[model samples]
Target: MIDTSSFQGKKAAYYTLGCKLNFSETSTFGKMLQDIGVVAAREGEKADLCIINTCSVTDVADHKCRQAIRRMVRNNPGAFVVVTGCYAQLNPQTISCFDGVDLVLGSNEKANLLQFLSEKWSGMSSDAGRNHLHEHFSVKTKDIKTFVPSCSRGNRTRYFLKVQDGCDYFCTYCTIPYARGFSRNPTIASLVEQVEEAVADGGKEIVITGVNIGDFGKTTGESFFGLVKALDSIEGVKRYRISSLEPDLISDELIEYCGRSRSFMPHFHIPLQSGSDSVLKLMHRHYDTALFAEKVRHIKSVMPDAFIGVDVMVGCRGETPEFFEETYNFIDSLDVTQLHVFPYSERPNTSALSIPYIVDDDTKKERCHRLLELSDRKTMAFYNRFIGKEADVLLEKASYGKAMHGFTANYVRVELPVSESLPEYDNSIRKLLLGDFNHDKTALKATVI
Candidate 1:
């Protein structure tokens, strides 16, 4: 075995990009480093090793990854850098060309990082050794064939549990299906045990994470509802939230279970890429506007206070004025809490590039702005409804301006001034009486009852 004594006293720092799923994976690897005696780099200190978890969801996302890599290398010139995740999986050589990068591991390769690092560090300390290390460091993603389970831990109150991995749905505008292989997940038994682990680690809430979470158990001969039902029985976790589910994959049984389950929270993030059936078809999304609206109505009927977040893409090939109008009007009619509006960017190697009639840049911006305005209205309306009601909020330590902040069980963002008794309540939940909106309406101001 290679001697790892040199790694024992070193410092490592991590930077993550993209979704909750990526954050969870980064946290997991950071903890693994901790286990081997490497601690996190202290504030204002350069790390001996730097890890960059990447995303390649869009063209801009790719650019951001490049920028982050360069910035990390510039700051910590001697640090060995490891670049991994979706961007690395899709385009490894591009990341490998960076000056300070010692290794580039793909999605499948990233999981077994300790072994790869051990092989590289077998002796000879200088640039010559590193150059030899670099020669054999490319771990390509032949295919993602298994689920790599992970959970987030730290000072945060909410934990992200990655129950599923990969995606089968090859949407025309998305590169996820290529970066992450087929949709796969662990059995319900495995995930329930992971939920128990998160609770034992003092997590109050758990967010189920994956590329396509709702498609869990397709290979295991189980359903998403079955997994939810299993997790609901875990005693210590206070609440659970679905990261984001494809509209069609969301079943009535799942919604109904959330309505009655004591452990599940009243929040749902369902993606409705386009409200126009024609647009949906072109995007290769599985559901239409009618089905999405029906699902929204069902959730509302069962739990009126539930927060529904929708994801929408503003522009795509063949999205004309008529189709754009259809999406806007459909969203306006829904009883949602907020909208995550994304202006579609043509990704290389995707089916969308060949589609006719590309939406102009100006049109994309206008549509994005209009949807953002609608989002603001929807978010404020959602917060307005709960005014004067008591909300149970899980507090976080991150200072929001001059005050502390947290999210209520219904997912309402609330702000309050820090108290002398605040330290005792970090990462803990407390009940508060909701007051009116704050001056800017970004979050509701609440008082402890």
Candidate 2:
């Protein structure tokens, strides 16, 4: 009942703000537009349409989403602007009120974006249709059940495969479950097919991403381990990295399997929101400090040279001075490669609000700075251990200054000089001898082996 004629020769500009999953979904939207003969707008060129995918993890993220939507509208004159993702799903009416926004879609509506656009475009010429179609779009969180599949590179050498969507954990300070809905995922067979397609398209490395990837089998009867086994069997993939996993869900069997697997790298990212067991309990986290420490020890025991990244949130409700000290000391004792430190941002309608203690903005900022400084030391220490050693690195296409960058199998950043004698090695795995730190000390300088 819709005409595809209108879509021909259209150019769209996309803006995504958030996690790897958002970027993957945006790439899927780009492909959908391409299927209709709509290409991406070139730099400095005005677009006929603009799609902005948003995030609402924190109030700061919500502010950024609003700013992005406004900037896109201002840049693309006369463009039909569409907004979707977490921010839109949670606060649809607020975004709909924005002056230049044409349409707003939530998580439930995101998968059927093309269909929604068709329905809206069919009647835009008439005043009645324009008025009726110019509202926000989203179903209740409970109604969001569909698991849309996404496997995309998104202008990167490493393809991000979305193995799962949504989450079931309703941690007191978290709003992800409310925005993304209960946990769900596609069948293992379908995911394997996606991986095969990515490989055929020249993808060498894949980072399995999700809201909670370890809880992958919520919809299907398949376990995360089963999915891992299925993906490992695929050919052409040189490296595989599990983006993030909960400590409790990271079974010892899985750790040992990854250690012995052919493709899975010696890198792990696990979140330990607060190192204080009391604070973790207050945050409604599933795992305790003892269990988290045990997991870290187990990982180091099996993969001695592995890179372990931990996520630490500071100054949440009920986190007193003593608690913050507990967190800092605990992290200092761990052999983590780096820390991803976040200052707590209070979300609406959450159990965290009921807690009596509150951390002032200045205190939160101070705690974040302290943790980040600690992170720098830990990261530098990890990089120093690999100096003068040869490791296989997957060269990425991105460049910084006069240097090119790539990541080793253990997730160590390596910098190579841009020399006339050197051949182009983008997207190719090559062995490199790690040397001293780069000019900025952000990565290890390397020479091709």
Candidate 3:
């Protein structure tokens, strides 16, 4: 344990990997540190501590965690390093074995990080890394029962709010159910307070996120649609976006209500998983392709301009060549804005690992390539259809090549010229006239009104 008495005027640098959910939790950690008078790590300065929030969605993600830990150890000498989140929860001992990791916090420990620090680091020693991280810090993953709510302030324009967490669906290929706990969420009143706090912090757009957000309030009497409806009533936020949701849980009522909502943005990112019904069944997916397509149809019928993004996984067990084509054709036929294609990776103890048909690395690469190409075509078509139209854009704080960038309600990426007046528009919503495609035709150039 390191001495907290030495923490005066110290700074911490946070490095996070994985989804918006992880960032949300990490930002909360930063806020906790600030409450204790610690500051953010500045440029060219060695941090007093470094926090790494990890992911283990795939085998590659585990390797990335190892590489990140080694980089932190090598670059930031004498800094106390802490590794936590899904990867840490899934394999605490493996992460604890890393030479520089001072603490390995599991799911529940990460939520209440301040208490852990106060108890474990109340001045045992500043030379904490010499001893095993397990000797001073450890937590069991199963003891994590309650939910830990988080809202990500990744920037001023967009805040990723985690209203729900965990998953009840034990899909064959997914380890999310084990890594996170059973599906649960904060009460409607608690979530409304979080949204209000986000808006108070000058947040313009709030992206709703979680591990099965559609399955919200499983332990409570409320519902996901009810949660969104309450958020729609909030006055300060300009727009909101729902993250990846299951198709079956996306009711027609939610789609229709959001279509007419003043605050809800016209963008839906629904995970179809696969277009082949047989493959979906093999993976123990809840909904079939027909249901998924019907959900898309409902959204398109209510809001034709709405941007629909689909998440497709390729190269899972039993997905033969014909099955691949079925998925390709089914997605191609859907009126979606874009595709997020992922190549399936085997996880330990998953049911998919026992299945006989194992896709080769070369085959997985090829299938991933095919879906990515299809995504490029779909995105170009979607953007072209919106050309010369007008939409509201919440100008973000990032830019490239002397131009500012923002996103439309339907998730269109738009760029505008950066000038002396651009700072005034930052984090503010502006009426943008989507005009022409830029050179190489990746993003649309817009004129701010």
Candidate 4:
């Protein structure tokens, strides 16, 4: 073990991969290390310690984790490489095999990272027995009961407040349940406190994020609607956004409340993996296409200008050209603002991988391109409807091209002319006059009122 007495004022760098929950947990861990006088350092800069928070969402995640570790070791050969999170919990042995990975802490052990480091550095020789991270590691999920305020690095106009963790759905194509374990949530009172704290910290908007946010409070008996109502009562928070939610969980009360809630933003992201009922059944998704369409209609009936984002996974097992066309047509017929299209990736131990009629890589690529083209059209049409209208934009920082950017309550991306008077952080809002979409509809440039 390296001696802690000699490590005072040492530098540390952290790299996080995966969902908002992982980002929040990394921020919390960063703060814990900071309290012990470990200063946060840049990625390429030499540091005494490096912590990598990993993900296991897709096959790409594994490749990315290994690449990141190799790069970090190359940059800081002397740094103690510590790996943690879902990937580490699921495949500790694989990560432990890396040459520079001096320590591997699983989910539960992550909270005790500082203690582990101290013990390792205090007169503990780097013997073969002490160096075997796989033998000393433990993986277990902690019972989360409190909300943590975490925002992305750099100047983020919006922050993601992790209100829930873990999933119980066990969908055929998902390994999130096994990687994250059972569902858990912070108490309503705790979440409200965190929201207030975020607002106090100058966050204009908060997106309630989680692994399976729809299943929130199932163990505590509090409904998602109840959480929304409580959050609405909190003053100073300008906008509240719900991350991706299940269609069946979108209740009538929640839809109506969103229509009238002053704090709730007019945006919703719902996942609809497939439109074919047979495919959905085999995928183990709870709701069918009709039910999903009904939920979208209900939300639109109340808030016509609401921005609806849909998640579609194409070219999964059993997804023939005909089956895919049905999904494409359903999405085309919907009044969605945008689409998050993902080509299905086979995951280990997933039922979908073992199913027959696996889609070829070429087919998946073609389907992905088709849906993306449709998404561009839908997004352009959605943005066109608001052209020449005035939107209350929470002004953020100047971008790479010296263009100032922000977002409206409806979640439209707006870029405004750079001005000295515009607010830099959470301190300013501008009444932006919307303009025509640029050649690429990814961002809409606007004029400041």
lDDT of each: 0.83, 0.89, 0.83, 0.79
Tens digits of per-residue lDDT, candidate 4, 210-294, equal 8888788976788778888998999988888998899988888889999999899999999998878888987999999999999
lDDT of 3: 0.83
Model 1 alpha-carbon miss at residue 330, Å: 0.5
Off by over 4 Å in 3: 1-6, 124-132, 135-142, 398-401, 419-421
Clashing pairs in 1: none
For residues 1-449, could you state the per-residue lDDT of candidate 2 as single tens digits? 55767787888899999998999999989998898878999999888788999999888999999899989977876678899999999999989988678899999998988888787753243222223234798989899987778998857589999999998889999999989999999999999999999999999999999999999997999999999999999999989999999999999999999999999999999999999999999999999999999999999999999999999998899999999999999999999999999889999988999999999999999999999999999999999999999999888775534567889999999988876114468788889999999889989989987
Candidate 4: where are CA atoms >4 Å away?
Answer: 1-7, 121-136, 140-154, 399-401, 419-427
TM-score of 4: 0.91
TM-score against native, each model: 0.94, 0.96, 0.95, 0.91
**Each prediction's RMSD to truth:** 2.2, 2.2, 2.3, 3.2
Q: What is the lDDT of residue 161 in candidate 1?
A: 88
Task: Give the distance in Å from residue 382's predicted Cα in candidate 4 to where it truly belongs.
Answer: 0.1
Best by TM-score: 2
How many clashes does the backbone of model 4 have? 6
Lowest summed lDDT window (length 10), candidate 4: 126-135
Residue-level lDDT tens digits of model 3 in 1-449: 43456456777888889888988888988987886767998876777678899898999888998898878776777677788888888888878878877788877677767767667553434353455354223444355676777776875578888888888889999877777777788889888898899888888788999989999878788999999999989989888899888988999889889989998888999998899998999999999998998999999999998999989898999999999999999999999988888899899889888889888989999999999999999999999988999988878765533777888888899888665227678898789889888887777898866
Weakest 10 consecutive residues, lDDT, candidate 3?
Answer: 132-141
